[model samples]
Target chain A: MDNFSFQNPTKLIFGEGQIAKIANEIPKDKKVLVIYGGGSIKRNGVYEQISAALEGHQWSEFSGIEPNPSFHTALKAVEQIKAEGVEYLLAVGGGSVADATKFIAAAACFDGDPWSILSEGARIRAALPLAVVLTLPATGSESNPNGVMTNYETQEKLAFYGRQLFPKFAVLDPTLTYSLPAKQVANGIVDAYVHTVEQYLTYPVGADLQDRFAEGILRTLVDNGPKALSEPKNYTVRANVMLSATMALNGLIGSGVPQDWATHFIGHELTALHGLDHGQTLAVILPAVMAEKREQKHEKLLQYAKEVWNISSGTESDRIDRAIDETRAFFESLGIATRLSDYGVTEQDIPAMIAALSEHKMTALGEHGDITPEVSAAILKRCL
Target chain B: MDNFSFQNPTKLIFGEGQIAKIANEIPKDKKVLVIYGGGSIKRNGVYEQISAALEGHQWSEFSGIEPNPSFHTALKAVEQIKAEGVEYLLAVGGGSVADATKFIAAAACFDGDPWSILSEGARIRAALPLAVVLTLPATGSESNPNGVMTNYETQEKLAFYGRQLFPKFAVLDPTLTYSLPAKQVANGIVDAYVHTVEQYLTYPVGADLQDRFAEGILRTLVDNGPKALSEPKNYTVRANVMLSATMALNGLIGSGVPQDWATHFIGHELTALHGLDHGQTLAVILPAVMAEKREQKHEKLLQYAKEVWNISSGTESDRIDRAIDETRAFFESLGIATRLSDYGVTEQDIPAMIAALSEHKMTALGEHGDITPEVSAAILKRCL
Candidate 1:
C-alpha cells in the first residue's frame, strides 16, 4: 500500500426524520443560504423540512443548481453571498446542488475568479461552512471535499477539491428519496457503482481491506440498487444504496491504493460536450475502459469478478471478460443504454470527444498514466 | 438500519516515515505530554521518531501505562499535565497508551473526581487536545473517542466516551510493528477480530453494508493475521493487520446497528478479576458467547458462517457451530488458548467471574439485553 493521509470530518445524520437534525447542525446566528435544483425538493417535501429546520435562523434560498452544475449559476450564488454576507450554505438537493454549494462556499471566500480553482488548480484558502440535506445519494459530494463544476463558456467540466470544503454536516434521510423518479434512482446506483470501480479495478497493491471494502460497496449496489427502484419505499434498500454511494467515494477506499479515473475524466467530457447526464456518461464509458485496459488491470479484474460478481469458474481472461460484460449488463439492467450510439452519438462523434480530451490535457490518464488520447479514443470507439 | 449520527475527525498519517507528520498535527506553542507504555517505543525507534517530531515543541514524557490501562497511572499523567499546564497530549505507544492519554486528557480538565466520568457518567465539558503515534494495531483508541480505563482501587474496568476525547490525529506507521513480539502481534489480531464480531454477529437489521464491512474486516484478519506473526517484517501483512484493527472498532460498522458487546463486557471482568490480557480474555470468551447466544444471533451467525468463514454447506445449526469452532481455532492458531483453563482459571473461577459481572450490573448484557447473569454464568461454564 502507498503512503497516504486521510481525514473525513463530516458528520452524517442518517435515517428517517434526520432532516430535523439540521436545525442543531447549523448555527442560528449565521445567515444561511439554502441551495437546491429545479424545485425537486419543493415537490418532495425536502424544502418544507429545510424550512422547518431553519425556522429560527435568518436564511434565503438560491434555486436552479442544475445536474452537472455549472460555475455560471454557482458564481451567482457567490454574488448573493457577497451582497448578503451569507455565513453558512445549506445544500438541499443531490450531488449537483451540493457540488454547487461547495463551489459557491469557496468562491465566496476566494480572492480571484473562482473558475481558476477548477481550471488552474488554484488552492482554496477559505470557504464558508457548508451542510447538506441530501435528497439524492449519488456523487458522494455531500460528505466528501471534492466537487465538479462546469464552465459554460469553455464547455469544460472539471473537479476541484480541498479540505476546507468538507461539509460540516450531512442529513441523509433516505425516506426523502421515496419520491424520486425511477430513472434518478437507477442513475444513483450506476453512479455509485462506477465510483467504486474507479477506485478499484486498477491493480492490487496488497491493500486487501480496501479491495474488500470496494467489493462490499459494489456488491451492496448490485444487490440493493435494483430493489431500491422496484420497492422505492423499502427503507432498507434505500438506506443501503444511500450509504453505499456515500462510502464509494468518501476517500476511504481510494486511500493507500492506486485509482483509475480515466472513465470519469472521459465521462466528464461526454457530459461537457455531448450533454449526457453524469451517470449516463459513466455507464457508456466504463465497460469500454475496462475492456481496453484489461491487460493492465488483469489481476484486479479477476478479483472483482469473483468477489463482487461471484464469477470464479473460468480462465483468468474469461473471468475478466465476464466481469466487464456483467458490469455493462449491470448498468443496462438499470435501464441505461451503455453504447454511445444508443445515446445518439455515432462513430463520427468520437473525434470530438478525443479533441475535448486533448483540449483538457487529459491525454494520459488512469492509474498507470498510460491511457493516452489514442487509448482513450479506442476506448470511446468501443462505446460506439 | 436505525437513526444514527456519525463523525470521526482524527487525521490518519499512515504508512512508512509518516511519523514525521506529527510535527504539523500538534501546535508548536502548546506544552505537550508524550505518553507510552513500558518504554517499548524506546526500543522500537518510535521514541526517536516522536522525539524528532517533537523537536520544535516543548514536551515531557510519562511512561509505564500497563497492558490494560488504569485510571491510577493515567491520573499521574493528568497530575503532571495540571502541574505543567500541558495543553496537548501525544500518545506514543499502543492502545493502552492511547487509551490512557485520552483518559488523562479528559480527566485533567474535568471537575470533581474524574472517576465519576466513568462511574457516574459525568459529562465531559472540556479536554486537552490529543494525538497518537500508534505503535500497535489494536483497540482502535488512537482514532476513536471511546476509552476503557480500569479503576484499580475499585477493581472496576469501565469505558467512557464523548466527542471531546477523540484524538486530533494518529500517525500509523506499520513498520513500527516489525519489532513487536509474536505474542503482541497475536494479541492485536484477536483484539481486532473480536471487535468486528461484537458489532456484527447480532441479529441482522438489514444493514447489509455494515455486515459486509464487518465481514470484510474479519476476512482480512483471518487471511492476514497469521502471516503477520509468521513473516513479522512483511510490510503488506503488517499494514493490512494494522488497518483492519483500526477499522474494526472505529464506530463505522456499529453505527445504525445494534451491537452486542457481551463478549467485551465479560472479557473485561476476566481481565479485572483473573488478570488475563484483554485480547486473551476475548479469545477465551468469544466462542463461548457465540455458543451461548447462538439462538438469538442465529441469522447473523449463519451469515458470518457463510460470508466470513465460508461454511455454507451445512444445516443452519451445523454452520453456526462450525463457525464458533473455527473462531476458537483461529484464536488458538494465534497461540492464544481459547479456554479459561488454558490461563489457569479452572471451573472454580466461574463464580468469581459471575460476581464481577453482577457487581458491574452487567445483568442485561447483549444487543437484546438478554445475556443476564445466568446466561453469562452459562457462557462462563462453557469457557471452562
Candidate 2:
C-alpha cells in the first residue's frame, strides 16, 4: 500500500426523519440560504419537511441549479449569499444542488472573481459553513471536498476542491428519494458505480483493505442497485444504495491506492460536448477505457472478474474480455446503454473530445499517466 | 436497517515516517504531556524518534502504563497534567498508553473525583485535547473515544467513553511495530479479529454497505494477519493489519446493525478474573459463544462460515459446528489456546465470572439482550 493520510469529518446524519437534525445542527442564530435544483423538492415534499424542520430560522432560498450544476447558476447564488448575509447554506436536492452549494460557499467568501475559484485556481481560505438534506445520493458531494461544475459560456466542465468544502452535516434520509424519477434513480446508481470503479480498477498496490473495500462497494452496487430500481420506496434497498453511493466517493476506498480516473475524465468531456447526462457518458465510455487500459490494470481486472463477477475458471484474456463485457452488461441491466452510438454520439464527435483533453491539460490521464490524447481517441473509437 | 447518526472527527495521520506530523498537528503555544508504556518503546527506537520529534515542544513525560491500562496509573498522569499545566497530551506507545491518555484527558478536566468519571458515570463536559503516536495497532483506542482501564486495587476492569475523549489526531506508522515481540503481534491480530466479529457475526439487518464493509475487514484480516505474523517487518502486511484494526472499531461496521458484543463482554470478565490478555480471552471465548448462541446467530454464522471460512457444502448444523471449530483452530494456530483448561482455568472460575457479570449488571448481553447470565454460564462451560 502507498503511504497516505486520511481524514473525513463530515457528520453524516442518515436514516428516516433525520432531516429534523438540521434544526439543532445549524445554530439558531445563523442566517441560512437553502439551495435546490429545479424545485423538485417542492413537488416531492422535501422542501416542506426541511421548512418544517427549520421553522424559525432566518433563511432565504435559491432554486433551479441544473444537473451538471452550471457555474453561472451558482454564481447567482454567490451574489444572493453576499447580498443576504447568509452565514450558513443548506442544500436540499440532488448532488447538483449540493455541488453547487460547495461552489457558492467558496465563491461567496472568495476575495476576487468567483470564476477564478474554478478556472485560475484561487486559494480558498474560508467558506460558508454548509449542510445538506441529500434528496439524491449520487456524486457524494454531501460528504467530500470535491465539486464539478460546467461553464456554459465556455462549454467546459470542471472540478474544484478545498478542505473547507466538506459539509458540516448531511442528512441522507433514503425516504426522501422515493419520489425521484426512475431515470434519475438509475443515473444515481450508475454515477455511484462508476465513481467507485474510477478509484478502483487501476492497478494492484497490495493494499488489501482498500481493495476489499472497493470490491465491497462494487458488490453492494451490483447486488442492491437493481433492488433500488425495482422497489424504489423500500427502505433497505434505498438505504443500501444511498449509503453505498456516499461510501463510494467519500475517500474511504480511494486512500492509499493508485486510482485510474481516465474513464471519468473522458466521460466529463462527453458530458461537456454532447450534453449527455453525467452517468450516461460514463456508461458510454467506461468499457472502452477498461479495454484500452487492460495491461496497466491487468491484475485488478482479473481480481474484479473473479471476486465481483465470479468468472475465474478461464484463460486470463478470456476472463478480461468477460469482465469488460459483464461491466457493459451491468450498465445495460440498469437500462443504461454502454455504446456511444446508442446515445447519438458519433465518429465525428471523437476529435472534439480528444481536443478537449489537451485544452484541459488532462492528456496524461490514468493511474500511470499513460492515457495520452492519442490513446483517448482510440478508446473513443472503441465506443463506436 | 436501523436508523443511525455517525461522525468520527479523529484525524488519522497514517504511514511510515508520519511521526513528524505531530510537529505541525499540535499547536506551538501549549504545554504538552507525553505518555507511554513499559519502555519497549525505548528499546525499539520509537521513543527516540518521538523525543527527536519533540525537541522544542514544552512537554513532560509519564511512563509505566501497563497493558489493559490501569486507572490508578492514569490518575497519576492526570495529576501531573494539573501540576505541569499541560494543555495538550501526546500518547506515544501502544493501546494501553493511548487508552490511559484518553482517561487522563477526560479526568484532568472533570470537576469531580476522577473515579466518578468511570464508576459513577459522570457526564463529561470537557477534556484536554489528546494526540497519539501509536506503536501498537490492537485496541483502536488511537482513533476512537472508548477506553478500558483496570482498578488493580479492587481487581475490577471497566470501560468509559465520551465524545470528548477522541484524540485530536493519531499517527500510525507500521514501521514502529517492526520490532514488536511475535506474541504481542499475534495478540494484536486476535484482538482486531474479534473486534470485527463482535460487530459483524449477528443477525442481518439488510444493511448492505455495512455488511460488505464488515466482510471486507474480516477478509483482509484473514488474508493478511498471517503475513504480519510470519514476516513481522513486511510493510504491506503490517500496514494492512494496522489499517484493518483501526477500521474494525471505527464505527463503520457497527452502524445500522444489531451488534453482538457478547464475545468482548464475556472476554473482559475472563481477562479481569484470570489476568489473561484481552486477545487471549477473546480467542478462548468467541468460538464457544458462537456455538452456544448458534440459534440466535444462525444465518450470520452460516454467512461467516461461507464468506470468511469458506465452509459450505454441508448440513446447517455441521457447517455451524465446523465454523466454530475452525475459529478455535485459527486461534490455536496462532499459538493461542482456545479453551479454559489450556490456560489453567477451572470450574471454580466460572462462578466468579458469573458474579462479575451480575456485579456489573451485564446479565443481559448480545444483540437482542438474549445472552442472560445463564447463557453466559453456558458459553463459558463450552470453553471448559
Among the numbered candidates, top DockQ falls to 1
Clash totals in order: 0, 0
Pairs in clash, predicted candidate 1: none
Cα displacement (angstroms), candidate 2, residue B330, comes to 1.6
Q: What is candidate 1's CA lDDT for residue A67?
A: 81
Model 2, CA-based lDDT: 0.88
lDDT by residue for model 1 (B1-384), tens: 988998999888899999888888788899998888898777767888888988989999899998879889888988898888899998888888888888898899898999899898798889999999888898898889988888888777778987998899988899999999899889999999999998988988989899899999999999998899889999999999999999998889888999888998999888877779889999989999999988899999999999998898978899999998999989988899998888899888888888888987889999999999999999999998
Pairs of colliding residues, candidate 2: none
TM-score per model over all chains: 0.98, 0.98
